[model samples]
Target: MSVDVITFGLNHTSAPLAVREQVSLAGELMKPALTALRSAFGGAVREAAILSTCNRTEIYCAAEPSAARELPAWLADFQRVEADALQPHLYRHSQDEAVRHAFRVASGLDSMVLGEPQILGQMKDAVRTAEDAGALGTLLHQLFQRTFAVAKEVRSTTAIGEQSVSMAAAAVKLAQRVFGDLRQVKVLFIGAGEMIDLCATHFAAQHPARMTVANRTIARAEGLAGKISAGTMRLAELPEHLAEYDVVVSCTASALPILGLGMVERATRQRRRKPIVMVDLAVPRDIEAEVARLDDVYLYCVDDLGRLIQTATDARKAAVVQAEAIIETRVQHFMHWLGTRRVVPVIRDLHEAAGAMRAAELERARRALARGDDPEAVLEQLAHGLTQKYLHGPLAALNQSEGEHRDQLLTWLPKLYPLRER
Candidate 1:
């Protein structure tokens, strides 16, 4: 049975925030997800890796083609979502298409914000997680290594990442649009994760009138706060303190909304219709969707920020063409490697059969030598036996074949043996 490379999942483009959040896996859930996927396929999924981020959730696997079709339903079952509902948002890629998708994703060509570099690190982390779960086999290992190489080549050789604009920068741009001058607004950041750290840095550079970091872990909040010379607060204090800030940015791994409609409503009441900018970069979302409906709240989710950052410069447009060409060339290279692997089992069987034949002939020769037969005659017989045995298969095929097959065999035999020239 030949194994195939397959990629299946949904991203910001294919699925909305609501659909994506339902299936998104946190960093700690990767191992368990992979193990479950492997078990669900009854070992047919020979190798697997799951890459989940705020913007997308993807599963890459090496499996037989027969088992590939069932993957979409399996994902729905595992994520406890209705298969019918999830199917529309899902995509499946196999063989060369799978290799191309992996390359494009790592190169950031497939990102919500094109040419963003963060997805490469996220992909590396996913590979590491798969390795830790013992789900990474030779095929996937080779794929990711080539994926990283392609990403590096694209970034270095092209201007793909040049004039880079990230989600963090987008958040700052949104806030500035709302408040006119960031220095006049009080900014509050929720969660101390990478996204929040980035938002803090960008907003800090703007010199907000006051900045604060609130996290479930006070120590983490304080650590991030100290770097930006901001104050720290416990996440629990948000209810009481929410109205004090003109700008609020949040990104966390929490499975539930930290700021619900009721909470935001109360905050709005306290502010007396004063405008507030809210950026929620979380997958499950730190703020509830209903908060967007509030009159005084300017709400932006990951998708909204995605829209804000897509104003690409002319250089970036040209860079995209260059990056895509690089990715296409690398994808072909990877597919060629996959194609060559199909002959591996046949080569292995040939070597094993030859070894057995050689051993049998050697044993017969040893017995003759023990019986004191002529050494030169034994050596000649052994050489003739090996040569004849090696030629038997092709010779028999050539004799049995009628036309085209025989012609192919005749053409290939000389290539198999350049000694025919002598």
Candidate 2:
């Protein structure tokens, strides 16, 4: 069966944070999700890759058409979210649209913060995870490779990322809005990952009263802390000292939410209603959704930060136009590749049939030669046999068809045949 390129899911544009979070999967959950896609549809699905970030949860697949239709439902089931609830926010694309979407996404054209480079890195991680899960096949593998190429082209050729406000920078910007001066407020960053490092760098520049780095790995946290002249603590100790900091930024790879409603609630009670600004940049989310409702807490998720970063996007709008044009051309090229792939089976079948005719004719010629027939006559018979067999199918179709069917055959037959003077 010829596989179709298909992608379906919700992004920040189509769904709210509540909807996106319900569908987000990462780390240990990814392998099982990829496995679920294959098992849920049996052999109908050939290859699959899931890209679940804070702003979007998209599943890309090389699948049979019918199997592609089942993806949204399969996704909702795996995430334990209702299919109906998910379907309204979900958008499915196949063939050219799938290629276009992948290109647009990797190039950061479709991101919540357009042209932000973080998505490219996230895409790389998703690809690696899919490969590890044995879910990547020829179609998806090529799609991603081209997607990366297109992204690099966009970044190098256009100024899409120029003057962009990064998520880390947006976090600081939001925090500064709430707390007038970072110099007076204490900042605590959770996780020692790149995001945490970026956030620490941005916040450290403002020179907070005290900075703290907490990670599951104390050594990693210490390394980050020592550079910023900040203190280091175990991630376990965050809950105890949570209320002490005025600004809390958390981005961790923990499967489950590290900071829950109850934990933040207690922290808020300790602060006596002093507002706490928290940025949760993790995909599955380092902070709980319910915690956002707390009166004294300012909770900003990735999408929320994305919205804040939009003010500066005006400068990069020109680059977006340039990037989109590049993407359109690439999408057409990719679709052409897919179009050729559809004829591959037919081409193979023709080759096989032709080979069979050659073998049969050559064998007959060998027998005739053994019977003392002339070499030139045997060669002539062999040539006639091969020619007749090759023309039989097309000749039969052309003669049997009527009106438009015959006309269609007349138009296509020459293209199918090697009829040109060679």
lDDT of 1 by residue, 1-422 (tens): 77999999999989999999999988878898999999988768999999999988999999999889999889898889999999999999999899999999999999988899999999999999999999999999999999999999999999989878899999999998878888889999999988899889999999999999999999999999999999999989999999999999999999899999998999999999999999999998889998989998999999998987878899989999998898888888888888888888899998999999999889888988999999999998889889899889888888899788888888888888665465
Most lDDT-accurate candidate: 1
Candidate 2 collision pairs: none
CA lDDT of each candidate? 0.92, 0.89
Give me candidate 1's TM-score against the actual structure: 0.94
Candidate 1, pairs of clashing residues: none
Clashes of each: 0, 0
Model 1 RMSD in Å is: 2.0
Q: Where in model 2 is the C-alpha error above 4 Å?
A: 292-295, 312-314, 415-422
lDDT of 1 at 177: 88
Which candidate achieves the best TM-score against the true structure? 1
Residues 30-55, model 2: lDDT tens digits: 99989988998988999999898878
